[model samples]
Target: MKEDYAFITEQGESTVHELSTVEALIKYQEQFHTGFPLTDKEAEMILGYMEGHDYVLGEVQGNFYQGDLAEVRERICWEEYSMDDVIDAVCEWNYELVLEAEAQRNNPEDFVDFAKSQSRYERLKAEEATLD
Candidate 1:
């Protein structure tokens, strides 16, 4: 039987937002259905697992997930990340955008070229104007 993991937010609270087994985690990842930034404890659980084993990322708002650890580390070196940063930058913006912009990759048509061209920082700034 596969071990099931639960994301327990707010520390001692008994509520679990999402739960999945190791096998299911990998399956969810392949399907792009996982979430991101994992709660503090969730990160610990992920680290406890052996490498190469499948794990699913917990999702929020249909974007951002555990797969972005590298990018998140890079951003954290500078300063704290805001919610908008997580949504637009980590989730919507990606390094692959550069490849697509350079014509080295292909993406779905609804994904706007101009929008993906902006860096996460730039996109956050532009979004501020829209919110005003």
Candidate 2:
């Protein structure tokens, strides 16, 4: 039974966005499933919601998630939250993506080598083109 939390982020030395419960954010996020579930429009809507625009699940298209949209809206309609509450909700909502991104970050040496190789290859290609 987590309380509603504000979806606040930096905005001209302040914060914005309304308050919502973790339950609602989880429900909204659940609408966009894995395995290529969301349509481009639907995916954009979810991204918009993440970027602080208030959009309910029913307001968008896509038959991906199976649940009561009314309940989701009800939870979203809440308007009271602390910063910690908001952080918890947002963190939970984005945990999987964060993990996925972190998983792709452990190859700095390989990336550097690959980049150097690519630069040399491009330079060689340019030199060959000039010889033509």
Of the candidates shown, which would achieve the greatest lDDT relative to the real structure? Answer: 2
Clashing pairs in 2: none
lDDT of each: 0.35, 0.37
TM-score of 2: 0.23
Name model 2 segments beyond 4 Å from true: 1-76, 102-132
lDDT agreement of model 1 with the native: 0.35
Candidate 1: lDDT of 55?
A: 25
RMSD of each: 13.9, 17.1
Shift of residue 15 alpha carbon in model 2, Å? 19
Q: Estimate each model's TM-score.
A: 0.22, 0.23
Counting clashing residue pairs in each candidate, in order, gives: 6, 0
Q: For this target, which candidate reaches the highest TM-score against the unseen true structure?
A: 2
lDDT of 2: 0.37
